[model samples]
Target: MTLASGLTLTVVLALVSVVALVMRPRGTSTVDFYLAGQRVGVATNAWAICGDYFSAASFLGVAAAVYATGLDGAWYAVGFAAGFVPVLLFVAAPLRRFGEFSIPDFLGRRLGSERVRLVAVGVVQLVILSYLVPQTVGSGITWELLVGQGVAGLSPYATGIVVSTAVVAALVSFGGMRGTTWTQAVQFLLLLGALLWLAATVIGEGFHYGDAVEQISTAPLGNPAPDGGLATEPNALHPGEPAVFGEPGARYDVLGQIALMVTLAMGTAGLPHVMNRYFTSPTGSAARTTTVWVLCLAGVFYAVAVMLGTAAREIVPGAVADNPWLDELTVDGVLTVPEHALPVLGRIYGGDAGLGVVAAGALIAVLSTIAGLLLAAAASWGHDVYERHLNPRATQRQAVRAGRITTLVTAGTAAGIGLVLRPEAFAASTPSIVATMVTWAFAVAGSALTPVFLLSIWWRRTTAAGAVAGMTTGVVVVIAMLTAGTVADGSPWPDLLLAPTLLAAPLTTVVTVVVSRSTAPPPDVERSWLIMHGTAADRHTQALARLVLAESRRRRREVRRARR
Candidate 1:
């Protein structure tokens, strides 16, 4: 099985490399390297964004959360899928219309302040690093299970981290956004295909979804104990009550649930990699259309993930007697590490081949996301920092070279962080550490970046000073709350503190508005607003497209007459 799995993984990586090489940017132009020449169509960008958005957190963590905590875990998927809605409504079109390389680029230019851009770069890097480390962690976890061997004296886990980061960094550095975009789009299809295959196999095995949920609900949820035994979890919502598989209290309480959802939902608008995909659109309308497709596609992907999580809970326990490997992975039918639920299910129904498909899917999830994050980091450092400030007169080739260097540095940094924080140290304390860490990134983005991002677009009075202050305040408040929550783990209000977007976002908004009112707006505020909210650019793009279509039709008619 390990050999077969290794072969499958090698094939997937080879195919990804081929795509990156084939689609590599033709020139060193910043536009080509960073935004794919602004030529990515609606469908391709939609698929790529889905690939970027659905990380290991979405692939493994969501399922693991569901397998571990039941209904409460389902919210992770719900929140993740819901996050796109705000993007569609308030962000997608305007962001593209603004026409900048990244979030920092847009904020800096819109507010007419270099200080705003630099401050935004700082916040965006924090968000990217926050998001990047977990992906490396997830890769390590998957590799540890799938291969179960080490390279060069490194543990299997460390090897996974180092290998994944290196491969993805090289792909991003060489292929740039053009190559990365196509590879990501293809990878997303593969990820979805793997999930669909698993779902079909489970259903074919006479598994009934509703009945399974009801059956599992009959018993209290049990997790792996510290002593390598089974222990029932207490309900956080209802103290003294045993957590149930079909209920909400297995992980978060009422307030915690709301906070988690809000953090995730609003955070999508602020994520640098996800939001940067919007800039690759040819027009604002195309960006909006791409987002619609993303919503539909993401909806299906997450729904399937939720179903599989439920399926794993129902089926794995009963199959333990038949599969010897299950003895070590599970405790009395429950997975010791909930993230293993999908891979274990794959092996049970499909044999080693099935496990290969699922394991490859997990690695692809991590790799695709890592590629996007590295690109985002590169754009920030190369375009935002080096090109704009360090050497304003840098040539196009120099700028692109800087981006490649940034990608390598960022990947190395993330890998180092992943190594320092081993999974064994925190696995017992969290339901799905991948998902939880991702939520923290969401909390920071929603609290700090989202409020200011929306304000800069919607509010004409938004000043650079106001935006800076709001972002700074948001970062400080979220960090303080998260730290306090960690320190006071057993307290009732820890849920709110841990997922602090609910508290941090509104306060940030108020601060932004108040500060903006007190200060004079940017001198060209009206012009920026028109560019952001007006349809002039969309209209021009439509006109040009019509002219091109007309010319093509004329040429085709001429060829037909000549043939006759």
Candidate 2:
């Protein structure tokens, strides 16, 4: 069958799922609607977390990065996966213990400051919107490549934007967090399975990973020759040879690379959607366990993604006219679609059926991620703003309605922005889609939120005033830097703007510290410190696990005796 036939079936199946999820009734309580009644199993919640975390970045961008930049692009996966380690070790358990529906809610309660809450909500919303728009862009690009359809009067890109936003908004509005979590978990597994299968098939076809990497490393990174602009040949390698962009020992600037890595690694704790997932776990232990699972799952997925990326770079020749859609996008007969490299590999290895599965998985990646972000955005706007500030007397149903409305508004706004800006498609890949957008989100979150959160949890003297001051300074700096670097084309900033998180975050720490020293610390800072570090809760969690295990053993023994 044709690729179009397979793609059509995939789209049909995904859309039909909306009916079953939306028809269900939402419960009255905030917990029921937002945290899935706090009964989500560890394994399920882990999958959902992966779903929320993967985004379009993981499905398309990672492979695309690999195809385009070789090992350097693999750092995207490393930074992303490493982000969770901090979340698990430092953020997840305490965050779950806080038992809030969203990060803004948790901060509002922890510091008892409305002003802080408001500021956080605004920052959270910005982060969500920034992240959301790119995912929509990614969805559009994927759909255009896969199905070749553009709904009435809309470009294929616009069609993707409209369809993805509508579907995700509908799912979120109807299901709330409860329905969304289940779908997200299932979707994550499907996404990973697709990645795994694709990787295995590539390897099974006698693809040599090491040889492929050597070839890619030997080739020049970025556009060849005139388009790529020349520099001095490296002491270690030729000017055209692929090398890190910054820092010593590495091909690139090491400091710059580490900065990007640290920003992502630290920023995961502050991301509203990711932070919100901790609330869905029933207990702190469950939250910690979820992170552990995430570590393992992410490790496997990223490793495979790098391999697939290397294989794509090696197998997919630079020639464009040989493949469909290559000529339209490729400059000077070379396929420029770095993102398409992976999809092409899918078609080559899996044929039409494989391409369909991979495409559908990519859609699921965007849908699942957008669902989580929209829910988080809704929680910030609906629960934090509408319910808490506007209509304090809102009933559970009314609050949920507010959440739905917020979801629609947020999704619509993101879709509209994507329709307008339409991320630049490079070569064969959606290079500017999910990953770059997500990087912006990380930069903002790292710069604005991570410094304050780390200080708040670790430093006893961290005053509410300090937290507020620090976050504000960070957010403003990050915005200014990014705006100047990206929007103001004539700005003097170095190409180092490619990684903004490095500069934006440390300045935030300095601002926070300088401000905190001048202000009186909050009186309850000691209590907050204890909550963050004291071990009583950890002991209780361990005891509870033992008790549950003992009970299960007793029940098994009784059943055995009865049978005998």
Best by TM-score: 1
Candidate 1 residues lying further than 4 Å off, grouped into runs, are 537-564
Runs in model 2 deviating more than 4 A are 1-26, 222-251, 318-334, 425-433, 488-495, 523-532, 536-564
Clashes of 1: 0
> Which 10-residue window in model 2 sums to the lowest lDDT?
229-238
TM-score of each: 0.94, 0.86
Model 2, 1-564: lDDT tens digits are 365645654664465366327534456777777778888889988998999999888888888776655555677889999999888878888777657888778777667678778888988998899889879988887777776778798988799889988988988888877788878887888888889889889888888887766665553444323344332223222333445322122233455457668767867877888889888888878899999999999999888887887787666665344566455644443335556656677776666777777777888889999999999998898899988899999998889888889999999999998888654532322233467678888888888887777776666666667778878887787777766756665655323464566777788788778877887777766555555565777656756877999999999999999999
lDDT tens string, model 1, 1-564? 377898999999999999999999998899999999999999999999999999999999999999888999999999999999999999999899889999999999999999999999999999999999999999998998888888999999999999999999999999999999999999999999999999999999898889999999998988888788788989988999999989899989899999989999989899999999999999999999999999999889998898999999999889999998999888888888888989999999988889999989999999999999999999999999999999999999999999999999999999999998876566677788888899889999999999999999999999998999999999999999988887775766877887899999999999999999999999988667777886786656766877999999999999999999
